[model samples]
Target: MATLEIKDLHVSVVSEDAPKEILKGVDLTIKAGETHAIMGPNGSGKSTLSYAIAGHPKYTITSGTVTLDGEDVLEMSVDERARAGLFLAMQYPVEVPGVSMSNFLRTAATAVRGEAPNLRHWVKEVKGAMADLDIDPAFAERSVNEGFSGGEKKRHEILQLGLLQPKIAILDETDSGLDVDALRVVSEGVNRYKASGEVGVMLITHYTRILKYIQPDFVHVFANGRIVESGGRELADVLESEGYVKYTGSKEAAALS
Candidate 1:
């Protein structure tokens, strides 16, 4: 089974004066078929953890190791990470002004799969996935995220997840901007992927609303750049009711003990 292991991860973002450490000695492990939800207040380095695992250049790993099934993920390039079965669905998906959804999906699938899919079957697969997500067939002709609503963009992210089918999928706030209906649709898409029993999901978010739909197997409370508390789905309930009052300030103090 595939396992993503992170040990003492420290990440920094270059600021105006110096590199600001965002993640401090964060350690996490995700296994196949497991869904881990990382919840924390804003600026607590939740997104930073996702980006660091995806090996975003902007965030430097100052210490610790990240490995996927024993292979050093920190040494791999961004595209390499994808090929090695890691995927990141950004909080804000970017726009590709001229790339059609059909073309983009096909190209991405080709790269990840190491060969172009059979044209006849590929079209059917795309059509089925889009329909399942309640995405209109017309979207196939539209440019990726170009002039689309936020909910539409998030749906498109799940569209990619369905097509790519990575071993570990890191979704950074996939629920943001979605209404009740859209959230349900997108959560279903994710649940579909999880049903495969071979994909692990790391869903990072601030609110527990999405949790009602996604139902993470494990809930991690991230604060001060580390996971301070972890438990079953009940942890989310506690956070919703109690808030992060215990972990809001003094990140250093919170993580140390």
Candidate 2:
């Protein structure tokens, strides 16, 4: 089991003159076997925080540090970070033409596990994971995420999670585009990944619907790039009832009320 720690972390997107600030001095801690949910209005830098932690090249860390299990993650390259037991499920999964799902999963697993997985065992694992998600084994022959629906992409991300078995999983908006059934399947995948008791999950989402399937250990409200409030799973229910209106302080929300 490992813990992900971020301290006074700041992030900015590159530009000509100066970097545009996105994450403004955010701090968070996630322990193994625990699920932390980050909820916020759009453009509140919730996704930026995940990308920065995963070391996305486009987001520069202006200051502070991110550590995993007491190791300095800020110093490691993205691939190194993955090998060090970190996985980020992207909001927009990219299609890599010509890369079969099996090939991609094998290559990524080899990279993340730092060794080639046992072929027989690996194949069985893949089949079981797909079965659990109700995905056809035939889908493995298709190119990675090519022509995949929104829900399929989300399920594929969870498939990677099951295969990789990272110590910490950061799911960035995995529920964003999923329909009801897909959302349930994806959430189930997440639950299965947690069954090992060796993995921790940090989930980011605007909607509280997914929370019904994947109960959170903690729920945080992010505003202006920082977490303004945090509580137990019930906070998710509050967000669903009232929306982000209280957190965002938007005039439109006030007017609607």
Candidate 3:
């Protein structure tokens, strides 16, 4: 099984005077066929952590390392990281007014696979993936993410995940705007991708709804730029029942008691 290891990672954003630190001494490991959930409130650096690992230019890795399958991820470019079997479905998918979804996904697949996907095979595969995600095949002809609803955008991300077939997928707040039906479709797409036994998932979100379908092996709580607590799937349930205020252990919460 492939492994993704984040060892003592410290991250910050680029700025003139001084870099703004986001991730602080974070460490975690995920392996093939496993699922991990990172739960946190807004501004807790959960998305920043994913962006840094995926080599996004906006997030600078000040220290530590991100290695995937024993390869140094920090040394690779964003595209190189994707080619090396790492994928990040953005929290807010960008709109490309000129590019059709079909073209964009095909180009990404070709790049990640290092060769052109067989025409007939790729078409069949894409069709199946689209159908599974409940995405209208007609939408593929439209410009990528142009005028797409929140649910549609999330499903499109999953479609890319299926077509690219990466070893690890980092989903950043994918459930944010999804309704019940949309959430089910997104979850099914993830499950289908997981069936291959080659994909490890790191689902980053603030809500617990998606956890019911993904069934994470490990659930971590991120706050103050660090993972303060972690446990098995039941941890997610605990958070669902009690909410973040209780588990976050804020000084305000302590003082109120």
Positional deviation of residue 256's Cα in model 2 after best superposition, in angstroms: 20
What lDDT tens digits, residue by residue, belong to model 3 across residues 120-239?
A: 998898898899898999998999999999889999999998888899999999999899999988998889889976779999999999988888999999876878899999998888
Residue 253 miss distance in model 1 (angstroms): 13
Error (Å) of candidate 1 at residue 9 is 0.2
- lDDT, residue 155, model 3: 96
Question: Which candidate number has the best TM-score?
Answer: 1
Ranking by TM-score: 1, 2, 3
Give the whole-model CA lDDT for all candidates, comma-separated. 0.92, 0.90, 0.89
lDDT of 1 by residue, 1-257 (tens): 89999999989899878888888899899999899999998888999899888888888889999999999999999999999999999998999999998999999999999999999999999999999999999999999899999999999999999999999999999998889999999999999999966889999999999998887999999988889999999999999999987787565454433
Cα lDDT of model 2 by residue, 3-78, tens digit: 8999999898987887788777898999998999999988888999988988889999989889998999999999
For model 1, name the residue pairs that clash.
none
**Candidate 2 Cα errors over 4 Å, as ranges:** 250-257
Model 1 residue 99 lDDT?
A: 98
Q: Which regions of candidate 1 deviate over 4 angstroms?
A: 249-257
**What's the lDDT for residue 117 in model 1?**
100
Cα deviation at 60, candidate 1, in Å, is 1.0
TM-score for each model: 0.96, 0.95, 0.94
Clashing pairs in 2: none
